[model samples]
Target: MTVLSSSSSRFPYAKGSDGTRRLGYGADYNPEQWPREVWEEDVRLMREAGVNIVSLAIFSWARLQPTAETWEFGWLDDVMDLLHAGGIGVDLATATASPPPWLTAAHPEILPVTASGATVWPGARQHWRPTSPVFRDHALRLVRKLASRYADHPALVAWHVNNELGCHNVYDYSDDAARAFRVWLRRRYEHLDALNHAWATAFWSQRYSDWEQILPPRLAASHPNPTQQLDFKRFSSDALKNHLRAERDILRELTPHTPVTTNFMVMGGTKGMDYADWADEVDFVANDHYVVHGPRDEGARDRDELSFSANLTGALARRRPWFLMEHSTSAVNWQPVNLPKKFGELARDSLLHVAHGADAVCFFQWRQSAAGAEKYHSAMVPHAGADSDVFRSVVELGRTLEALAPLAGSEREPARVAVLFDWDSWWAAEHDSHPTARLDYHTEALAWYAALLRLGVRADVVPAHGTELDGYDLVIAPVLHMVPQTLAKRLTRYVETGGHLVTTYFSGIVDEHDHVWLGGHPGALRELLGIRIEEFGPLADEDTVGVDAGPAGELTGDLWSDRVDVTAPDVEVLARYRTGTYAARPAVTRRAAGRGTAAYVSTRLGVDGLAALLPELLAPAGVTSELPECARGAVEPVVRRDADHRYLFLVNRTDTPVDVPGVEGEVLAGPAVRADGRLSLPPRAVAVLRGPNR
Candidate 1:
């Protein structure tokens, strides 16, 4: 049995106060909603769960600033005192959840104007204009005031700036936004001619003689061009960033020691704000992961997606532990069919988040509400109290976490492989007018990611630009459409020096300006990949192409199909389409570089194709993908390790019983692959298998 740590003791989280590994729950406790007696019960429950951290002041803007200038802290004081007394660290929010009703009445500009030129009202939260200077001025004041008040508080561990920036309808299309957009475009294009050239305005007789002609591209009239639509997405992302930076800068000034992070939605192409760029401003990254396994348990819907998102955040965070900012303890109110968490699914889901580099696991709310939008949402204490199943699961998981602090701080070093994930390219590629509208960048990356995950190979998603690729034995660039010249040279060096580099279709088609690279398909990669594309064709929705992808027989897929010319003599054809006009031709080919090789996947195939491709690719580099049979009905398993410790996480997304291997006299649990060879897992449960004693 794990002994619980006292709340008054120093935080047991190992990655320093702000480095990475930290454990806590996202506290949405509001004593203002309940009586003072209820607040005491909330603390006891949190202590039971071993939740050392809590996110406070979120959605309390209306409560704190009930009137124009009157801010109330009497209720907040009691709540904070109780949490600290219970030994819970606080990630204080600025309480700007929704601008106070009085602020909106006094200053209508604080409200956002939607794309349709309609000004949104104050009832709903997150409707404030991000780019409005007035909003910034007021938001900064609130943050400064809050920081000054809580800067010295020992309970304050971090700062969560504003609840989900840009989560509502796109705002601020008034004159101010138009003016800012014009300024942003000028800085980007430098001159009218360059802007016209990049936007290809000459072809449509849409030449902008003056910068003012660029009226933010879609307020009065929606974007006509695909590239412009993409740029608008990028611009919107920047607008969101500008809002966040305003608060982040102020908070850093008040408390430079504490880390600050805004919750980022995973598997999303946040238009203008690149997560990579955002990382520089944040001390660490945190994302809200809500996994929903649908009713009747046909299949696991949200579990794998959440884990993938966690991994993506971890990759961007550089293996630093991330916080699970928000996850559902039970059924979410917003979903069409609100299904409660299956038995053990909540704990399994939480473990899954931790397995994929989460230091803290926090649910959206701590107390179930009788009113409000999220009232139906589950919490630590349900509307029915501790008798509920959700409360039991929270208590059980909490007790387990208190004993796992040493494991929490440990890092997850991926196996010798890296996946190039570029936010800029994702933004750019979606906006491009490719023949196929179903070009899913997230799905494509997941194809490779899922393959790596199943193999139990640790993969890190690094920016395509300037990230070190020296140590990775194999680097896979999936649909890398925008290639930085510097990255091209690096890839060339990697391939030339006997390092393996793999790129898929649409790999290197454009430069940073979104300009097509002249003279063939995979622009800069042609010389290294030893292939040039003469003509490319898009497959119809019902269409399918077959390729003999090595051991995996006849891989098939729709959407992307390619034809290429093998220019390098040393290149070997690995697989080719067995059907079509280009029948019996090479679909997957590899070129022998000095001591290494570069493989080109000319088409996008399904999961089976990836399973086949990775083995052939990783084998030459001496990398192995483990295929352990999951206990029946269990979701797929994932494993990550530190230098001498291995953490095996198995998720039981299915309703039926599943078996996982158990650990005995071992450092951790799950299957053990010794110097010899062996593997097995007990039942639906997850195991953290530790390595041999050094």
Candidate 2:
């Protein structure tokens, strides 16, 4: 049995040798890839860049254990000792990211199987099956060996269970996965009758008589069972979590003083693992976020999505300081064009994460790799070496972080409005047989966030599960598809107790089991929203709809426009559709319930439309911008509060200089303060201001 540690005790993780807490700054250090002579130079440069910590031996499983019978410790020992001497801490990885070639060769069954039953070979990383006992035993054996060897090493600060748990090999459909899936199902439902009811198996005859008869949602003639696919996703995430626990348990058994964490990829479209559910499993939440290049909007979603993910990560940490495990320093090799970051973007991105409560800001690598699949991936030290622009930016950021060292133990100041994010909704809504197949949960969620940013209103992007909605006056949950009974009641109670809610279309339609609610469309939320719909009117790829809000103005939208009918007498149609079969019908509706109001949007309004609509909703909640009138739309504000003072992070979103007047605070590591008591920021820059918290 695994013993749980008090997460409170692990606060202020990764301290200096003098035991003083400071923001950790470094990257994933793979000194094993470099020669002995290069090792000395690496340490020297790390000190120059103000690097105090690095995640070591992340993908070194093959090197650490050459064969089943052999063990290698001398190289790791030297690297640890060298880092300690260089005044750097190590977040040591378990090296179980991939099995050694010998292990995979001896036991090929350990490899993952696709839904089509094809083997996932070992050319890439994370090829081992999460549920394979053979793989688990060997992995745990290696974990035990490494933990025992480096338990007392001075360089060790934290334990990284695995690298990006479910990046490539999350889903598996082999016999092993089938057996494990069955075990998980039996544990969850406990009875065949309950299982059948939950799965709704009477439709196509997928009901299971025996627990052993059910298999993973593999390739089928038509679309597989929706509930089965949802359960499989849940089971797959759990299986990987189990593997993380296995390695974390060993590390805790040996070194109880050390903290354990796994890097969560909380970026765009990477939705396999539910990080919120796995938050407490670690000592502190650590995330790996990468900005994806956009094609349609010319990368308009890139920065906004980055901020959204970081804010959501902070919410996962419950607003506590967490670790930024990996991000790019410049152009990443994975994208199509691979464009380098624009001037001032490098510091702006890093500081934006810090503003969202990242105490440790690190990247994918310490040095650019000379050879590998990720050789072209940007790093702190690029291929051009220490004299390069990337390294110069690294040094400047290091200096900036040092100046902002007082921000180490601070927590993110709570915003009055919050945008709820749900992995369940993202999973279930986009499942194979969904409406239009063009419904993107992240895109819609980001739309709300980008609107908030454009309005200069600070809104925390928080996970819907286990998060307290009572704290916020206005709660926006976009595309909240999977609403269980408990969640419905909780949201209802929240509104009754004076919390305003704004939800978009296709929300509250399905229960947790993928079964639709028996009532009208927007099923669970229909009564609250005071609007009912019989059917969805999803549009074609080129179709558009005009939403007419009197005096407020007309807005254009696409993708979805539902036929809405007001059910409650008190409900008001805020906007109406001006085009199509539902012409002059309710496009947006609002109803007062108890002490609060509930609002609904019937179409997929892009950023601009959402921005225009948000003002009407926010006006009733009395939400306004903290920024000055001139800097309202162009500046993004994030506040972090310590015991006495608040640190305000102001990020510039434009490409030209912006004058931010009426900012009354002490300037700490950002744009220079002027004699006129105003601050000006260059394009894509960030500024920190300190003031009295009260």
Candidate 3:
């Protein structure tokens, strides 16, 4: 990921062969995996599937340069020309995603070292360490060669910097990383004394007299210092960003006209990279998102999580169109139980990304592998070939994207309500020695999203840091634990300037250094929220706390609860603990500040609980669903706008048919509109409606 700065002159989008700009629809084309005869068939199938672009040579390092002294460009040259002739553009990769066996055998030290001192060998991809100068030198050499070779190719539409970086090798405990960490620390904090103060070394008898003493938070006898762990996380992400800068610089210098971008893994447990910080480095933000399976949830919940990820990615791109680099056409091989996508799930999922502001929708691969670790993974052409249902859906999705060519470069319309996701807080809040180990920061945020979906409220999930708070009327910051003085002041100013705020438990507890705000619990926000918490009353796994919201029904809360006391004169206690250790205490409170108001929830309210409480909190601000009452919860609404009209995407998040009344617009995709101006969508289907921009 690159730094989080706005790029005003980003490449608008990739144009089609007919000299018209259109939404990119394709997959990662790995022609190196098949015979030369297969290449001709691949291009034929690609055309039949309506694929305009293919990201080529992502992991062809070994075959591209077989040995140190050898260069094999004939096969790649033919493929590039063939794709160009077939009217398919190529997002050419530098082919440096993985180190060649010869290079690794010569310089094994470039391999990453785990916290436990185990070397990560070269059997898998992304084996090289980010801080290894040896690895960087070799990678940059390859990048320069690829860029110089493809600089004049007509098929080269964009430069794929490298495959998903830091996916497998984010955390490295080698000597290279240690030296880089010190350099990053010096750049961040010029003096050792400043570093000592920020890390609070006095507590652990770990005060550093010199810069060399500091190391990554590697495996140790007991729990490492909290601040050390947090800094290491920051440093690791920066290390990867520096490498991306290195690759991007070479590509820019060689092919000054080509736009360079690297894929970011923004889904599930991949928290090592700060994507918002890396947004500005590329020409266009590209993200690789796969629906995480397992205990998280399934079906509609899974789609909600996907929508959450796409929403955050759109925010990272500053609401401009972004590239959906990689997703599945059917099942992914990685998850424990690989579940194949149902009938309409494939097209439904892709359109959801487009609705959230993706201008390009691509899958993991073009063809299913004959032999590889991902043979079971689905592709545009499945193992059963193009005659299968998966490929049929691929063709249908391509037609849909073509019909959506009119909305290609449209920006994502701003939602009145926004959810702020903080990477720093996510890193610090989950560190060891917290009040409760069961506290999951993202789960709490996703719960809020699920609640918002149930209420049919459209909200953009934006990065918490450096966000334009004035753009949104209501902002929800969940588990905002690492609040620095700057953020505190910014949030205060936002509320004072008539911005409605809703924050949950465990927020505003610490500063940027992971140091507790000394006064009391929920530190920095205590004054603004007009409430004080003495201590955290975390419940056992099976225990539950009954909260009474007066007129609303009683709801159950688990995992965490706080003992709150009102400090402001006009603060209102919206809910009370009906049954708990501190029975009848304030469980939720709100206070008027300036023209707006701030509210706090002290318990871990699941999706249903929060949904039950949102209406009252939102009424005063006049923030209600724009959708009609009959279609509210059953359909998820997302809007995109251009100079003329706004496109409304109505996604059915249910298994049964849903009728959305009062939907008046021309249908560009999916079923036709009813005579009564109602939208009757099939299960797992998406309908795009174009209406006059309001």
Candidate 4:
């Protein structure tokens, strides 16, 4: 057997024993969906496109195991052998993404129930409850078998544990979930009194005397207890994580050398499963993202969404290059209305992921499915075959990736700005009983991040809790609703020692258990911010408040407004409410503590409002933009550097051409370039420039 050794690249790519570094291309290979004759053609096209890697057996559980005891590996063995002979490596899945019909039919109790008490039928993918012990036993059995069979396979380079775990059924409110929730709560709160107190059950006469009385937050009378719902979200995420760990453990014991990973849906539709906490369990992080459509104005919003998803995924991987496991070659079938990409969008989007630290780029499937729910989804081999525009773009992207292979292990330029994005806070802040139902955690954070991106400042979307803040000069936390005491202390020290902070409304209001910190609102950060919120004045959906910033002129904000009372004389009011019952009160304030500064924004400032405010907020931290001021909002510049060279990725998100000045470099990719200090970027074009590290 030819043993494939791993690469020393900072990014995780499958390596071979010959010490060759190969870029991972191609897509999910579902040979089971096609006949044996088509498999050879698939391999032929893959080689023609410069493809080197393909994920196999992702949803083949039913075919791999036809019965309770009977197992079949004949087809998979043939496929693997064919791929190896074709010079392609395999990211072999354990085929545990979905259970066989027999298993689900035999143990219907393992199926998941929704919050409304409706059973999610097993016809769809990921239909089983995460905490089902019966399901785990069967899943582990299949995983052990696959691991032992493929441990020594020459084509096997990595193990894909499952296909997007918890994508469809993240939360299960069944009786089994109720019992598991009780156990998870016991481990969390230790005693019943602590759990009751933390949940504040005394208000509703819902205090539990025994652990058995506790249940998953199901349909409740009014709203379920906030902390109970919070813990349940944690529990659900941990449950899926435990399943991943189970499969990971089996694979490690059997094939210690091969790396293991699972695809994560880190896009806008995802919630519940915290990928940050799940990052360590996988050898490398893999993510699936699709361009969100339905907006009337699509170009800029889609670019921002893709950039945000890619940057967040890279940060979750600790700035290490991760994998773009799934993205559409054209229109995705799952949106409200699927819109196909324009002429240059395929290469633009793929290279955009590479710019944001993705080492590998793969799609959903190699060929367009003739049947199934995703039949209309685009693939490398589109319905038009190899002569089509999509296929030509796929082949072009393969060649581009080959040219960019020298950048495999490179990292994104160190970001001086960091945005705090906490999944726990995302769940807690968006709970039913919040001050405003319109306050979305990710939307708020994305507003701030988008503003920074417009300013041409690269920012890392980092976790709120347990992330080190020493390296960042500016930290922005928008609507950080669940700031624990430890995180509060870390932020305070970060500001006191010279880091600048800008946090928005509803922040620092609770501990880890969703218990409010007494005294005034903005609880733990009151001293650092030098302001106390006496009351929260949530706005109606249509209502807007005017903020007067003196020289910066008036700005409009909505969704939430806090009645701020300045507590310290040193705190300067940057902006005030121009009209309202709280007119002339502070809407934005900044305080200097020790050597650093902390600023508090008391309302939801839309993108334009933040764009107006970021200049003053960033000036104190000595952070400035790399692009010309004229090109600030028109073009987005992202820099990634290695030991030898710096690569500048300039993306023009506008419809008209934009000229970026003072950027002199050798053109590495994109359209025509001249040796002058300025480059004109076409509409929706992406330019990759290589220059000296200075």
Q: Can you list the residue pairs that collide in candidate 2?
A: none
Better of 1 and 3 by TM-score: 3
- Reference-based TM-score, model 2: 0.98
Per-residue CA lDDT of model 2 for 1-694, tens digit only, reads 0111225425435355676658889999998888989998999999999998999999898888898988888988999999999988899999999888999999999999998889999988999899999999999999999889899998889999979999999998989999999999989999999989999999888878899889998889999989999999999999999998989999999999889999999999998898888888898889999888788664367888999999998888878889999999998888888888987888999999999999999998899999999999999999999999999999999999888888888889989999999999999999887778999998899999999998899999888878888889899999999998888888999888999999999999999898999879898988888889999999999999998977669998799989998889999888999987789999988898999889999998888888888989887688988888799779899999989999999999888889988777888888877878789988898999999999
lDDT of 4 by residue, 477-561 (tens): 9888888878888899999999999999999998898888899989989888999998899999889999997666798989989
The worst-scoring run of ten residues by lDDT in candidate 2 lies at 1-10
User: What C-alpha lDDT, on a 0 to 100 scale, does residue 692 get in candidate 3?
Assistant: 91
TM-scores of all candidate predictions against the true structure: 0.89, 0.98, 0.98, 0.96
Residue runs of model 2 more than 4 Å from their true location after superposition: 1-14, 296-299
User: Taking the tens digit of each residue's C-alpha lDDT, what string does model 1 give over 1-694?
Assistant: 0011112212224454556544565455666788778778778777776677788888887787777678777777777778888878888888875787778888888777766778888776876876678877877878887888888887877888887666674446776777778888888879888888887787667888887777654443433665565566667778878777888888888888877878877643333456666665566677776654445442333554566677767766666567778877888887787888767667777777777777788887888899988889888778988887888888878765654555676555664787887776776677635757778776677678666755556566666764677778898998898886877888999888878998998878887767788899889788889998877767878888888877766787567778878999999898988876567778898999888899998778865578667788887788764434444224455555556666655554455544444332243433353433333433445555554434
| Model 1 lDDT, residue 507, Cα | 79
Against the reference, the lDDT scores of all candidates come to 0.71, 0.89, 0.89, 0.86
Better of 2 and 4 by TM-score: 2
